[model samples]
Target: MYEVVLVDDDVIVTQFLKRYIPWEEHGFKVVASFQDSHSALEYLLENTYDVLVTDIGMPKLNGIELIEQLKKSKSNSYHIILSCHDEFRYAQQAFKLEVFDYILKETMEETNIIALLGRLKEKLDQEQFTRNQHLKVTKFLERNNMTLKSKFIEKLMKEQNITKDGWWKEQEELLKLNFSDKYFTPILCFIDRYQEAINHYENETSLQFSINNLLEEIFTAKDQQDVQIFFTQGKFLILLPMKYNTREKTKHQIEAILKELHETIYAGFEVSITSVIGELNVKEQSLLESMRILLKNKEQRFYYKYNSIQNFYPISYTRDSIFQDYVEISQTIKELILKDKKDQILECISQQLKQIREKKYSPDSIKDWAIKLIIDIKLSLHALNHFERQSVVITIADQVIQYVETFEHLEYVLADICEKFLEQIRSTNLTTRNEDILKAQKFVQTHIGAKISLKDVAAHLHLNSSYFSRMYKKETGEGFVEYVTKTKMTKAIELLEHSTKSIEQIAFELGFENKSYFSKTFKKYFGMTPGDYKYKTKEKMN
Candidate 1:
């Protein structure tokens, strides 16, 4: 139904006109009534009305004059003029202003004016309904555009040398506004324990509703003129202009407010907060730097913090995942052992476990750089083993899973394993069953840097040199000398790549008298000099 505004200086005339119309039956509502034209004009400046009815002969601005003046004000209202004369000239002037109807008070009855209004009211309702439809479509388009803004940001941020003022120049009409500010701000918010949150909510409909409803509330409460929020790469970005208070622009306090808002309102998941403030820089350079600080610092957070969890990328996750993958793969190995699938069971004994070989890693190593080969294998094994096997060997998979949850835990687990195994191997005697092979492996692993030959190894094993060489080749396909060099080179590369020791330092560590000879052997095994190999490998890494 159309909204109606009634204007007349006489209070009785206004009230009589108002009561005479059956507004609901006429498909309109009397939404406003004014005793003076000034109040009606004031209302017109701030509001939209479909129909304006006023008395033509008034003390101040008359109906015909008001209608003519309102045209200059960009008012779209249809006018109905009330007059007291039977003047044809007045009718011509009213018609000149495109007044929908003119009612002469000297001759018109209340029913006659009501009937005229009823016809116009129906047309007004139709126009209002159509106008409402356009508004709905426009709002939908605006929302859709906002959803894509995050994608635009993702691509924009990938550019190397972009500046704050660049996007405005690059495509001025794309956003339909000239940016007057010097720079833009980037904020990254992520759902922490996201997997856990998904698990906590069973159904997709409920989970989606919960996330969307909470985000909706936040956005709806704030002025959305310069704000945007969306998900990318399994995380959310609440990117908007960082508003500085005119009185005192305290960046730290604003950051704290964001943290507190997340904690109070969005308590379902933890958030990580990463923000770059100021128009001094609009590029991701500041975001990149801030992310470095975020990764270096550890903060304890709760559920609501998910919307605030921020980093330059999914890096913290990558570091934490290494240890988690190790534990998961360990669990798979234990499962295969329990199932007694001995054919590929040993093959599954965490073969990729070799990836961590002798490397001293802090909690931050291998972030966002671990190969898909590792992650895919881990995911495949996890999916399969979610309900796969019943283990018999008192599965330490669960224990190891918790321990290997991050690089920090990986180190602890490794040191713990080495410590426990060293004591166990020392106390537990090797049976005569393959005692020779165990002793030989121990010797090869231990004596790689020595100049000992097959004869020396055979003598140490208490076997004749010719017989020992054949047995060693039979037990391991490799001949005696190759085995020693290969083992030595393997350890040498690990030390070179992962440790801080230099080539000369590694020579002493490996018991090699000649560093040059050690270098030669390393080059032979890896197809490059140690220095060149490390350079090429590290360069290729990222």
Candidate 2:
């Protein structure tokens, strides 16, 4: 609700206005009423009001003087003037002060005052709505600006050569990026256990956003200049500028910043990041090369722990004799898979990767070998009819190949593929057993009241009775005759419990010709005659 304050030098007028104004009915509440303009000015100094009503003619301070003071203090209240005099000077002064309304005290009416208050309320409401709309538009533009900046940084990084040309200068001005520095250094920052972080956040975009925000805060706090941070393929790339005069000093400063970044991440998010710094002599022409070098240094991360900072060094490769036994390794992997030796298959893949890494083969050669091994395993599964369609295997193989950048990454992919293949084989074995056992179980369950024999079932299945009997026993742990007799006894017990059938009728319903034989079998199974069992059960119920 809007608040209003009334000021008048006449006590009677002030009292009447306070008691009879119906301010609340017009969307306002009279919070204060004063017979002294001085006290009213003092109240206005400390409190805020949505509307102010005061008499124009006063001793020390008039309505015009009070509004002028309010305007000087930047109070945004609507003012209405009340006076007994209809002098031109008073109305002119009120008009000059931007008074919302001028009324003569002798002609004042409650209805007119209420109508004016209503218009003031509408104006306030419109202003509030406009302010809210402006705030929303501002926030939207800020978010869009950030998005566009990120895209521009991504594009700049991907470009092969980035020079300070005309177009580059235009972009620099538009995006507010400062890239005219003499020397540039690239730092590659990778979140440790990135997949676990994703799982914890349950959303990759939110995690990335949080990390970016932290980086931006750190950089801004340190007053780092000519720096750009962007994310690509789950890693952060920061381009830091260095001055020629303080190259060593700048390098040490960057190292300190990286250390702080690592500690802050661990403290805040319980995660560590590994940062690799590239050469500090990178110029505009060599930005792409610097990026490549920094990324290559990220490969060395496999050898170190989290929160390590290191420079790039060439990996020394020595050929191993195991590469000559590629065919034997392939055959061994196939044999292990077929034998369902899960642990041995993983061990073989690990050993092969170790040999390949030691051989220091080119990335292309390693990828080729890995692809071939994946294909051979897939073909073996197909030959055994373990998988119905080849598309699934091909898709997995393509993923492995697509992600094979480093030797360590290749090993991870191959291990994952081996695990998937093991799962497929296990599922296939389970499905085969279910298909056979479920069919037989369904047949027996559906024909429970029929006088079915082993030969009859075998004929229906197109198998010899002897073989079918042995298979059923092996699968269900019961001989064919034993199974059929057990099924009939189970049905006979249900009839005795829930049905009012006579013993002879129950026996006939269960495919038992002789009632005496059925009772004997029931006694053997339950250690009691059917009549005695039923009578005891009824007694317990009573």
Candidate 3:
């Protein structure tokens, strides 16, 4: 509702206007009515009103004086002058003050006043709508400007060489960048626990937006000209103008700002960041080099404790291979996995990871060790008839390990893989208890004298060849080929111990085409050639 005030130095006129105008019906509220212009002006000066109706021929301060005083005070109220026939000259003065309309006291009508109020309400509504639209446009332009600045900075960081040509100058002016030849400090920020943070944010853009907003709020001080640029891979760069002349002071300043930033982000977003502040340098080229240094030193973050702030330092690659202990680590983990000691396996993994972390091994080396270890464990367990050969974890181990950015995250990923391994182990154990698996094993033992195939056994059981093969592996944890090979080897041992058959005859009977191939298979399975095994047996007998 538009509030209104009536100021006439006649009690009858003020009473009639207040009681008969139907102010509420016309969306106007007569908040004040005065028989003295001075008191009305005092009330108007202290309070707020949207419309003013006042008599011009009063003593001391008339309606003209009140309107003039309001105009001088920059009041936006719409004014309607109440005048008599002799006060026509006062209407001219009211017009100069931009009064909405004039009303003659002798000929005032309720319909005319209501109509004027309606028009005034429309004007106010239109102005409000225009103001809202202007505000929205302003906000949109500001947001767009920030986006353009971020994109420009991102491009500048990626460019190998920056030329100070016409286009560069144009962009500098457009983006309000003052880094022509001024020395500035570059700092790199890494979002720690990025994999988990990404899951929290649901995507990269949201996480970037949130961090950028926080940076803006923290760096918007008048004394600071620090520009934050979001680089790829959960990394952001800060270009701080040289406020302090010496390198030490500038470094100290950058460190303090980063500490605040780290605390602020963690407090607001529940996320931590690792910051690497580069040395002070001059110009865009220097900045480009500085950025490269910051990014190069980002590798050092892999070994950093979570949410650490550090001066830039190059990463030193170790000459010792992380894989030198590969055999020991792999064998230990494989044994734990086979034993289905999930907690022990995880603890063993944690101990080894801690050792790797303490060594400060390069990220690539750690990843290489992890990938090879996971694959080797899968293969070895499969050979032991404890896991499937083509498991999902085996297929994606390289990709998963290579993408791990931090040792903490790497540990989580390794634990997940181990959990899957235990799942496979438990699955295999459950399958060995399956009645169908036992029946399949019986079929294999009963047909041990013949060369058996997965399809042949699958057909005898009236199951799909492909489906049976899959179910068999999923249930028993070993492929049909391995099961058959082990069964045949056990049978070969029985025949050699009990019957007087030559190794070649036993090999032919067990479906080996050549004695050498059979002996090689026997050596691989039993860790000795058939002749060595038989000779050892005969010597034991003597």
- Whole-model Cα lDDT per candidate? 0.56, 0.73, 0.77
Model 3 lDDT, residue 207, Cα: 81
Best by TM-score: 3
- By descending lDDT, how would the candidates be arranged? 3, 2, 1
Q: How would the candidate models be sorted by TM-score, starting from the highest?
A: 3, 2, 1
Tens-digit lDDT string for candidate 1 (1-542): 67788888889888887787677677778889998887887887688888888888876777777788788875567888888866899999999988888888775676797788778867777877899999879766655555465456555545556665756365435654334452334454544444445667764334444554566566567754544454553344454455444424544544664666567445654422333222222434554344334223322121122244332332222232244344335334434433334445434433443454324233224322223223332332222211113221222433453323343333334334334323333443444524665566556544545666777777888888888778767755668777667656755655565555678877776667777987887888878888887787579866
| Over 4 Å off, model 1 | 9-16, 31-49, 68-74, 86-89, 92-97, 150-184, 190-542
Error of 3 at 328 (Å): 2.3
Candidate 3 has what TM-score?
0.58
Model 2 scores a C-alpha lDDT of 0.73
C-alpha RMSD of candidate 1: 16.1
- Candidate 2 local lDDT, 347-402, one digit each (tens): 88888787676666656556767887787667545534226452345556865475
